[model samples]
Target: MGRNGVDRDRYQASQSCSDRFQGAFGAPRAEREQQFSKFMEHLPLAVSIKDKSGRFLFANEFMKDLLAADDPVGKTLGELLPPEEASMMAVNDHQALTQGLLLIQNRVNDTYGDERIFETYKFPLPMPEKRTLLGSISVDITERKRAEQALALKQQQLEELNRSLEQRVQQAVDELRQKDRLLIQQSRQAAMGEMINNIAHQWRQPLNNIGLIIQNLQLQYEAGEMDSEQMATEVGKAMDVIAYMSRTIDDFRNFFHQDKERQPFVVNQMVSRSLDFVLPGLKNSGIDVECREEPNVSADGYPREYMQALLNILNNARDVLLERKVKQPLIRIAIFRENKRSVVTIHDNAGGISDDVLPKIFDPYFTTKEQGKGTGIGLYMSKTIIEKNIEGSLTARNVDGGVEFRIVV
Candidate 1:
């Protein structure tokens, strides 16, 4: 055999004897080293060991793959990473080894233009050689960090959108409410105008009657032939006229004061009251008014306001028939209970509304009457009172010969 080959065999024999002696004393050192090497090689996380000088003593397969190095053992960190990063890692590693403290660091690494994040734990491994660190484990956390950042950004965007949407929705609701208030005010003004017109018509005949009676009384007194029975009868007639005027004023006051309070009332009574208020105008216009008695027809809603709406419809019918100068103007009101619903119908014998105007009749500020005479919100207010306040339905349709309004509560 050659001299070199003989020397190598001698060294192997001596190492085997030393291993057997260590095994005889306790767990074999060579066996323990072999098991530890195997465990480190198969570990999922990167593992490395460094001496107190910060030079690499050992590197496992995972560490070699992370560093992209074929032979990492005995290499210094300066050779594996940039100067700045290597210096920082060396300082941390030396401090951990000397103080016997754990060092944890999360850092971003950029090598070959590819960026990655790592979480590293440097722990002091219990070793016979005090200056040597036996374990340093690092985990790559690039994907997890990116996912968390993405989620935070999405949450922020969603919160911003929600705030914007809430603002827009609130603004729209405010605008609609404002429009509703304006419509109600316009309707109230129109109703007042109609009431004034009716009042003028009612007072004309009564005032004329009073004037005639006063003239007759004056003539009798001047002639010195005023009989006691005749005087009493004249006084009674004057008192009756005053009482009728008083009732008319009281009805108007009640209708205008509907906002004072609400009470559950019979729907039929409200309809009757509305008809009575407008009966004077209807009579002068030669229009006949009729209503069906329905004792059980009642509602829990605002009775006064609803009655005002009904009165407005009846007044409109009277105005239309008077304008047309119909030979036989007729207004019929009917009330009935059906399927837990109270239904009211109002029909008039005035000419039916034109097709072009019927669709927009309920719209605020839309009217067929002369501009100065119509405020044009009566039907609109009635719609609001029926749908929003009473949870009811109101609809108008042209009949074969006239117009009809139907309400259901």
Candidate 2:
């Protein structure tokens, strides 16, 4: 009887423990389901579960916020979205559920006098029954779309600005190159003129000597006293005059050919050559030239052409001074170095240029000389050569007694 009572007590205790375990675990599961429902109530994106028939099985807090209603479950999407959108959404959801596919769409939602764009994805549930469509996520893309559009507009504007700037820069470069070519051609022409003038002056003295020699030869021949040696000497003198003229032609040819190529040359030597070309005219016109020795001023490109430009300026000054009948027709040429720049100053005692004409001196076709005497391109060409070709500067200033042309490179 004692053994039977022990077995019965043990059986009753086991049953009681099993009942307590079932109750504890079951109540917690119910509580957990309630908590999960509360959590889904406050999601930010509209959350919904739908059946294959496009009826809502569940709608979360966000859905309620979107619809401004409660108990939206079991309702068709047509009750929420506009008729067109609702029909489209229902079709997309039905396709996703039936075909086990995913659908993504970008669509606009209108509310309160504004439009909001959303990107929505409808995906099928993995359940085999195909009765449930698992989930849909809609993201607000309105601000992002606006920003992208703004960025595209700005990019287009930037491209346009770059194109305009490139065109303008190219135009400027072309203009500069055109100016350079014109200046070079003008320099060649001016050098040719000076060379011709020098030849004319050189021939005068030689022609006079020849004339005197011929007169003597004729007198001796008529008297029947012409000597062979004397004749030879006279012939030799005449030949020397011809040879000198030939050499002058050669020099002029070389000067005019300066546009062929560029090479480094001594500045002083170039200056000397230029002076030789203009010296005869200067002497004949009685214009005194004073040039200072420039030991340190050397250039690296187109030595002959550069010297031609300088000589043209000096010759122009000389002509101006002589034309004005200045009592002391003086042209001062000086070259010095300052701040890594070559400075050439050509000043003349020609009472300075007139204020009325100063501003137009460097303009093409603007000259103070009478017709056929000046082409008016000399100063303009000079400025172009110095500034555009050599990357230098040329400026004219009126001093107390004369006009000074300052060139810096």
Candidate 3:
């Protein structure tokens, strides 16, 4: 499909998500007012609401400012935006309303005539009187797109350089070593983005707590209840949250630091530690993850490199579940010893990959994800690390409902 074309799939929001904003029955009036306030003022993403008749019902400040509109409500797309942009949005809106939730990429030139790309999620929002309105959350992805394009160009240049070097130097060992260095460099670059996302997940709750603490202090002060005990208590709570965030940063920094030499590590312990880096994001996505480990299993290798491989596999599982919108998504990890070899298996219930794609899953630059979302080197580097660097075995198979990856060292 072309860049302008929509890549769509059926979507239903999860119950846990629905419960957050609306319980089994519905949100209370006061709670809904608070949500409205946050949605309109605090949200940084552009959001819009449109009725079936194509007249805008409402738009958040971000969306309004983007369009430079005095007021968007009661204005049709054709009346509010440039014809080409309006037409594109109108078509997308219609599809979202009729066909269920849609994730689409759109390029638009706002009133200022500056073009920007957006990654938008449009869904049908049920309303009072059994009415349905189109709701959208759009995030500007122009910078992210540019970064992906640059990374792709750099990868192409590296491939060309490698070809030239292979022709000039006939030493097989040296060429292989050079390729390994480049692979590690590329893997780190790709993994860094996900690590940052994990960092955000690690800090989200603490940040929210700190914000509430500040709000409480304000309320207490205004009500003349700000005693020394309360003052010390709130300040302490804020400090503790700050400390936790600091420790999270330290953990991430250590995870990414290159290992200088091989080291002995406990298998179960390493698996637990590896989960720490990614568990937060996985849970936030509502994926159920369970670890069943037989303790005391040991392995000898570069622990950091081994952890990187685990990160790649776990991330791929998460992406698959999210992309497929699988119900009750679950990832189960088991660690044990088989035939005196330390074994770790990770499996997920997202539908298994196709037969034709399974054999090439470990091949570099082979990805099933849409453009700019995947570099296709993660699994390749992962297999290389386990089999080559760690001298371990990594294999994959299609289980009954999903895929399983086993690692032995």
Candidate 4:
């Protein structure tokens, strides 16, 4: 409005309030001009007017404080601002002159060297003498921009975390499946070894009987007493023993068969079948075994796994009896129903397990036997089969004079 400074008279002459508010509000020229100057000085927004050449013609009090400049009038943006910011302002001024209106968002450093964002509106104003001025108002938007940036970063982090969690879960599932396969293989290996030992014990008596029958036939022939009826009788007795030995193989095969489905089966029957495979060894070892069966007690689960668990317990009992060789060695199996569940208890008199060793008996790879003699997964797998697969429980405790293993289904 004035050269080298703001001239009070020139600034007052530029006020067009009277023309805008004529009949509705009447006031003296001086009074209206003072009101306009006061209003512009107190406004919160940064307001300024520039010539077509991007030179500041007028700047409000807020604009002066925003730029930290002593006087902005008659100064070009290039002279008043840093090179990069001046260049950006120059471009915006040119667009406002050519396009009539321009709106933009920009980043700039304030007088304190702190960064700030501004949403600016620029428009052209035609003056009386064919001259044009560009007017602009800007509001700080730094907080809003920072919030948007922070929200975007958080969303990205959450997505990456979700992906990482999915990968970890899949890896865990794969590991569990591998462990299951290993357990099954180990169980089969243990069962196979037990079967071989039992078969040896089972066949020994029948083989010796056949040998004796052959010896008897020789003796009869030498004496000239061999008759057709006597020969048939001797042969029939030998065949019966051989047939009984053959059935042992069938029993072993059925015991190891993998069952795919669960069904209701008598608990006592399953326990008896498991004992059949080990009875010969028990007899030969002179470890007396007695079964006290209770009728009509049934369960719903994998019968083969149930049998395997029972066999493992029995085998453990047999081993302890033989290893310790307790006087009058005895192992007792009892099956009955209690609390609406089938229960089986196997008790052995071998001085029971030591207090320290009893607690860890069901832990995987923990064995009392020498390294090559025990796979240790037997009791652990048995626990898994009963608790997880069969939805039942297996527990061990020291009784009055022996160790008791109990299964509840």
Q: Which candidate is the best by lDDT?
A: 3
Stretch of 10 with least lDDT, candidate 1: 5-14
Give the poorly placed runs of model 2, Cα more than 4 Å off: 1-137, 172-191, 206-243, 258-263, 354-360
lDDT of 1 by residue, 32-51 (tens): 55655566679877877665
Model 2 steric clash pairs:
none
Off by over 4 Å in 1: 1-141, 204-244, 258-263, 354-357, 370-373
Runs off by more than 4 Å, candidate 4: 1-156, 212-236
- What is the Cα-based lDDT of residue 333 in candidate 1? 88
Name the lDDT value of residue 271 in candidate 2.
Answer: 69
- Write the number of the candidate with greater lDDT, choosing between 1 and 2: 1
Every model: Cα RMSD to truth: 9.3, 11.7, 40.3, 7.9
- Per residue, candidate 2 scores C-alpha lDDT tens digits across 316-345 of 897798788998688888877778767788
Better of 1 and 2 by TM-score: 1
Error of 1 at 291 (Å): 0.8
List per-prediction Cα lDDT, in the order shown. Answer: 0.76, 0.73, 0.84, 0.84
Best by TM-score: 1
Candidate 1, residue 290: lDDT = 82
* Number of residue pairs clashing in candidate 1, backbone atoms closer than 3 angstroms, sequence gap of 3 or more or interchain: 0
TM-score of 4: 0.61
